[model samples]
Target: MKKVAILQSNYIPWKGYFDMIAAVDEFILYDDMQYTRRDWRNRNQIKTPQGGQWLTVPVKAKGKFDQSIRQTEIDGDEWRDLHWKALSLNYRRARYFSEVVEFIEPLYQNSYRTISELNRAFIEALCVYLEITTKISNSWDYQLIEGKTERLSNLCQQAGATQYISGPSAKDYIDPNIFSDAGIALTWFNYEGYPEYPQLWGDFSHGVSILDLLFNCGKDSPNYMRFVKK
Candidate 1:
């Protein structure tokens, strides 16, 4: 049976996010929704000298219409510089520092100005680095990517998916009958059971970006991901 997972494209999300994608046959990049400021698209956890700090992509809100992920512009580039500088200083003494530096250099150079593009870059790069082979599709390219839950149900059925996975929060509002009527089985991505890797600062970080694990553990991070059992 074909399985699928739908998620708003986020910036280099933590390990469990990728695990959910890897668990299914088709992973949907659900990026057509209204963009909110100060959200996961712009802010994520990263290791720092002090501890796990939130690295955010500053956007010019301009009090405009709820911006599109494709429209949100990267404001001051200072946050990018500061984050890189901090990571450089803190991880310079790390064992896998060289590998981390090489991997992240391209990200700093690109300096993505829009949320959708930035999210795409992060997800695609992570998939490549992690060797994930699941077919990824952007929701905007296909119809049924819209605000209502009915549309989402149709999208799942149209994709020829027998199973659909979503974040745990989805259960609160999305009527189960929608998927049932469409003959799509629904499951929740329980990310509550992920394992901790070799975190840099000797603390448990549950929600940081995946780059943190990659940087500290190098190629061994994949081993930790497997520790998350059903």
Candidate 2:
């Protein structure tokens, strides 16, 4: 059966996000939806010696009302250098920092006008690093319907997915009956059993960016993420 997952693009998302992508046959970047303020779409937590810190991409959200993620634009070109500097300072001592730094540094150097573009670039790059072979697509390619769950269900149907896979957080709002009505099986993904890998700083946190795991564990990073190929 072809399992499909639909999730918004996130900036250097955590291992759990990639795990979900790895578990599905097709991963859809649901960018046609409204862009929420202060969400994972433009920012994400990164582990630091002090604590988990946010590295947010400044976006121009002044006049746009309910702007779709694909239409949202970056505010300025200044965040790139700042973000790269923070990562370099904090993760410079990571075990495999040198190995992964070359590949990751260029991403920050390149210019991106939109948040979705920047996020998709990183997500695709990290998926390759983790050996995840799932086919990735954009939700804008499908004709979305109105309503929350209906839009998701329609996206799955458009992709010809026999099964719809979703994150556990969606259990609150997602109706299983919707998928049943669409003749698609529904499955919930759990990110609870992740084992801590060699992490920097004192306490380990699973909420930080996947770059933490990649820089710290290098080739063995996939071993820590569920569903990722070894």
Candidate 3:
């Protein structure tokens, strides 16, 4: 059976995010959904000497509040250098910092016009390091129908998916009956039980970006994550 998962693209998302991607056969970037401010779409947390710090990518979300994630434009190019510098300073001493930097640093240097592009670029690159070979696609690539559950179920059907894998948070609004009606089996991805690796900071946090795991564990990063095979 073909397993599918759909989620909005995130900026250097946490390890759990990649875990969900790795658990599915086809991962869809649901950027067609409306963009919300102060969300994972533009920023993610990172560990620092003091505590967890947020590295936000400034986006133009003032007046155009109804824009989709794919349509969202970045405010400026200045945040790029600031984010890269912050990561460099905080993770410079990580065990695999130098090894991961060879690929991670250049992502910050390249220019991306939209958040979707930036998020996808980083997600694809990180997947390579983790050895995840799931097929990634965009929501707009398929014909979208009406209703929340109907749209998701329809996407699965269009993609020839027999099973749908979703995050637990979606249980608040996702109607499983919709998938049942479409002859698709629904499964909830568990993000628990992640083992802690040798983190640099004083405290261990699983909510930070996947970069933390990569910087600390390098190729062995998969050992600390769920779904990804070591």
Candidate maximizing lDDT: 3
Structural similarity to truth (TM-score) of each candidate: 0.90, 0.97, 0.98
Residues 121-200, model 3: lDDT tens digits = 99999998889999999999999999999999999999999999999999999999999999999999998888989998
| Candidates' RMSD to native | 2.6, 1.2, 1.0
lDDT of 2 by residue, 1-230 (tens): 89999999999999899999999999999999889998999999888878989999999888787899999999888999999999999999999999898789889888999999999999998888778899999998889899899999999999999999899899999989999999999999898989999999888898999999999999898888778463
Instruction: By lDDT, rank the candidates, best first.
Output: 3, 2, 1
Residue runs of model 3 more than 4 Å from their true location after superposition: 228-230
Tell me the TM-score of model 3.
Answer: 0.98
lDDT of each: 0.77, 0.91, 0.94
After best superposition, candidate 3 residue 66: deviation in angstroms? 0.8
Each model's total of backbone clashes: 0, 0, 0
What value of lDDT does candidate 1 attain over all alpha carbons? Answer: 0.77
Q: List the residue pairs that clash in candidate 2.
A: none
In model 1, the worst 10-residue window by lDDT is 221-230
User: Which of 1 and 2 is the better model by lDDT?
Assistant: 2
Task: For residue 18, give model 3's deviation from the true position in Å.
Answer: 0.7
- Lowest lDDT 10-mer window, candidate 2? 221-230
